[model samples]
Target: MPVPVPRQRDIPATDSGPAPQASLTLLVVEDDPAGGLTVPEILDADGHRIRIRSARNLTEATRLLTPDVHCVLLDLDLPGPGPGEDGLGALREVLRIAPRHAVLVLTGEADADRAAEAVRVGAQDFLYRDELDGRLLSRAIRYAVERKRADIAQYKLAESKLRAQENARLERGLLPTPLLEGSDLRFAARYRPGRSRALLGGDFYDTVRTPDGTVHAMIGDVCGHGPDEAALGVELRIAWRALTLAGLCGDDLLATLQEVLEVERPCEEIFATLCTVDISPDGRRAGLCLAGHPAPLISRPGGPARLLPYDDSGPALGLLPRARWPRRQVDLGGSWSLMLYTDGLIEGRIGEGRERLGQDGMVEMINRHLERGLSGEALLEASVTEARRLNGGELTDDVAVVLLSRAAGRTPAA
Candidate 1:
């Protein structure tokens, strides 16, 4: 049989200086110290000396198996555990100790069956003692190294693909699809994470039309920007939807949601801020509830944008078990657009100064967008984009915004 050829050398060449040659250190484990398993000093195709370190037993082999050792030449006939024990125990031990390194088994010419079994047991290749030579040994070591590298690379590629598929499934479940099929209300939302290339963060929002024809909307923020926080946000949004569909409203709904937060949070210090609005069936009024969160912005067809009352807002969820979120009535005149958002929208710095674009600044920004005849997705996009620009870069927090609009005479009478 023809021997395998070594691949092109990885050593770099230089025009102005002597070329660098590739080199490798190999560990050889055997039992016959008198057989003098010696061969002529070998050099790789690149003329670099190949270093060899010999070990008399598994104990010594392990001591020599440092990070610099690239491959192991194991003797299949080496003595293993006493009678009745696995005769190949030495080989098995080598495999377990140096899993990342390439391995080749050395055996007698008559032991073909045993050599083949060794190959199946993780050896890259098997060598017959009678045919061993410096040239063949060197070529085999190089080939084994390259093969091991290929195996590891393929494993990493498969792992990365699997993770990406899992992330896609998770993102789909986290993002909500509006339940406004029969309602005349218009809905739009935007979300962005501060983490680069991250799919989601702690910010979340949802909107659904109840059986009684009222539209319920919410936007919330968990205190951190991490996968755990994003997961908690998704859990909260799902629970809110389930409760709202079950006829829970106002204080009762908020109270139960706070319980969910307290029970599900990773730690006691973790908390979440939330804002919920239930619009009247006639589309002229709403019941607003805030839990340590900013109030929603409301703008009429001919009126300037302004914030709804936030003075009665309660503590954030998970802050105090007995905290209460009182629902307050607010008149959302006909033909109005109400925008609910997370703190990310207003926390961005206005300029180089330390001042943030607080509630007042955000109102002014929205009014300018409104004057430009922007509405729906266009308006929401402009608001977020401008915030990032004014902050000098992307905001280092999660931003979630939801806009609900109802036109005059568009809804069926309550």
Candidate 2:
């Protein structure tokens, strides 16, 4: 008897009975003008009748293939299509058309060599036409379907791992390596991107000692948290470093950076908050400039920690056409530590409330860490850790912090 076929046409709704449970579908591609090839009544693993659809040629098979069809049975002797003179041509065509579906090849006992070749070419399995029966075909179809699913899953996992490795290499290249070769100041920085599995974000910073024995340090945050913003931040950082090395400082350096921002930013509405500090050769005096950024905190040996002057800060970059940022000079005592940070450090929510750990809370947290004798990397690590603890989880924004310290009786290395 010929295999039972399911209805391919849509049936009008009737209140007489509920819709039938969905069953597994199989497509059979073969050329049997004499109607000799026959498929017995096959039942799936769940005991439901497996619906069959017959296609006489490649064209018919292509038209019959649908998303709901889980498996395909191709006859190796059914000629036409593909390069091989052997009857495996039809098998190859079926495989190409149903890449995501399980496939089985049917062949006579004499053509065992071609059947094995078919498996190597991507068919799930092969069956002898003489041994074809309901029980055997059911088990083979089930195994082929599961094998195809496992193959696809393995491919996706490998692709994900390769992508992660590439991203890690790229991010490491983009991060800054401080150029403090001839400087006596001890530098420490901590960075954490808000995005999951990301090493870098829109926040960027850099420290470089110029030929004039001055150390130029900067920290800035782009307006958004996306790859475009991250790219813009990197461009701004590279430009800042190049300008500083070229003897640009104070308002001139920032003005040129603004120009780069205007040109590189993905949109006109985007802006960046930045803080720049240029330390004199002797390390006892410095010039500070803020462009709508948070003021840096200074801690001295004999006094409390406090924020630098931000009253003279100007508008953020890309905000105005002719904006001017005034550089304020501040005196550094014999021994002190300066901390520069982005807003992400202080903007995390406290507990489950809407209140944030603003600058005031950050100052209090830092003072406590200072009392505990945490300095350099340890200090920065503790501060960030405590902020995360207070917020009850990871901060939803990128955080970048830089610390520059000058010790008494310490001088630049020759």
Candidate 3:
């Protein structure tokens, strides 16, 4: 009597009419030349016929194992390729070949222990040859395929989380920390990167008080907005601090930095803009130098803020070989505030239009904030917040702003 094949529940039709179901293919690896083992006709849960292909050994099984084969069924009695006649070696070979595909092992009822061991060796499930039927095989294949997909997804999610944590640690280590101990000048700064979820950008800044009481401060920007550029910026900043502490200043310090930039930059086309200020011990005067960068804004007591001398600035580093960045003398007067910033603060759009808030506009905006008696960190916070508000959104570049202030006849905060 011919055994009747069981029918699965029919899949319902969608609004667009009967949806077509994809067929599943299975590969059977066994040593059955005399038709000793037989597979019953199988149907998927969606009532579609499941295709089956047979191979005599491991070698032939690999040839028939195409990407379309979603599941593999192996017989434990099959001989392995190597000399050792372990009953489960063939199963291991199948697993190595089809790491992404679902795998099943077949064994006799008496060898059920070996079949269970095969499952521990990476097979999705195991089956007894005497009990094998169309309905059971079909259900096992579907479960194995879904389990494999879930495993891959979980592995990828863990990998992504580990990468983000590593990046956070690296970026935090690279950020600058000021060395202004025993200095009278009040220091405050704000930094924001345009790249989403990034802790550092191409802009970098630092401030340090030398043993001779001269406080040196600097802020710079690399030409690009990538990890390579950010790394270059950090290198330049560390180099500057080392040289300044070693008693180098003015043209000599910048010349050495240009040399470092030339050697460390990724390409010849890459360049960096820089601004450096050396405040004297008395805090009434400063030496300024600009390398294709914006000038620092100075605001005196009871007066409007204005830009310092930038007419004698030199070309940006890596742009001109042997270029000279002349240091100009500026009088800050007693009790004044100096603000140094990058081009990101001024390059933001004024509104929905193409017009940008240039240097002149920045001067006016600072003056209004000064009238409101905003100073120190509050002033900086207001300035950056207003800049973003005026741009109608987040600025699309990296911003770094530093402010140093002094009060007449008032002792410096400890």
Candidate 4:
């Protein structure tokens, strides 16, 4: 609560307002009274007295720290535990007990380098023994406290920016790409971030083609959201791709992924839901795997859109080490469409009172789009946008949708 001194040339022309009442208590730490800590008179910038409390050692400094102490002035000449623990040790312990207290160090005239080191380790700044005067010292104490607070704020802002950048990179890495070279089928997908943009928490999807002409695609969700969980989702997606390229599919692929979750997850009680589709070469049948995940919706010409059968599906990944993922094959007509999506798209409440637009609601919504003649990218965009609108502003959960369509009448190859 010490008074703030104006900068070098900013002295007020209208008589600086009444000095702030002197409530700040400073603790002076020095080993020997005869050696140093012998400032003749310490006073505020406007001549108000500064209550001084002196400590002869670290032990005494610990006792001198109290609620009223705003700052600690330490002696750098004190004995050390090592390069990291000389004056820094005492400064850290002081803060451990009083985290908000500002710290300043007193150093020998030639110990400028060590003084800088102390500041780097968390001290506000340092003052040479012989250069301390009442006004200059008071100003230093006031400015040091403000600088420390600003430093913490800047550090948080920088940490946030770095996390955002990392999330962006991770997002690009986890989502899948279409590998259908020289095919008429157009691939369209979209992802919307939830309330927290830490990463793709609520939704995830991936696609990769195997040595055979088959294309594998998946979209899933990890229950309960945050950056850590989102990161886990990304890890699972990458593992799935690597395993697919390595020839692991169906049950074997998911079992190994569950092992990864058991080892890498930050804690227990976390689980993930997944939906996967493997399209046949002739595009007439799709093998679907539902691991405690929502089933995909199928849209076909002259047929009502409906949820793909998901009976006897396995539990979500990470819940059990040996859980089985039952793969079911469904035959598609000549021309067909399959949409795999995370639950975030449906959990959105349409009009309050705990009413969620469940699986049936989603199927009906898609049929509405069908009536409007919307398809491909336009259809996916409209569906996601409407979901958000129903939820009233962002859905508050990550949403990802992947659609794979098999065009009609391929002329019955050969």
Indicate which candidate wins on lDDT.
Answer: 2
> Candidate 4, TM-score vs. the true structure?
0.75
Can you give the lDDT of residue 260 in candidate 3? 98
Candidate 1: tens digits of C-alpha lDDT, residues 1-414: 122223333433342134333578888887766632444345566667667787877888889999888899887777774555443777788888988999998887899998988888878888887787777888899999888888778889999888778766767656799898778899999888877778888988889999888899998999998888988999999999999989998889989999999889998888999999998878888999999999999999888999999999999888888788899999988799999999999999988999999999999999999999999999999999999999999999999899998888885533
- Estimate every model's Cα lDDT from 0 to 1: 0.85, 0.86, 0.85, 0.77
Which parts of model 4 are misplaced by more than 4 Å? 1-25, 31-54, 64-70, 77-102, 107-123, 193-195, 226-228, 247-270, 301-304, 317-326, 409-414
Highest TM-score model number:
1
What TM-score number comes out for model 2?
0.81
What stretches of model 3 exceed 4 Å from their correct place? 1-150
Q: By descending TM-score, how would the candidates be arranged?
A: 1, 2, 3, 4
lDDT per residue as tens, model 4, 1-414: 112222233334354444446545678777775633544335555554456787777777788787778788777766543465676676666657666778888877798888888888788888887676667777787777678678778888999899878877877875656666745455889888785545566567887767676778888787778777878888888888888788877888778888887787888988888888887767788788888988899999987799889896899988876688978989977698888888888989887668998888899999999889888899999999988888777887788898887778654222
Q: Give the range of the ten consecutive residues with the poorest summed lDDT in model 4.
A: 1-10
**Which residue pairs in candidate 4 collide?**
none
Question: TM-score per candidate, in order?
Answer: 0.84, 0.81, 0.77, 0.75
Angstrom error at residue 40, model 3: 8.5
Clashing pairs in 2: none
When summed lDDT is taken over every stretch of 10 residues in candidate 3, the lowest stretch is: 1-10
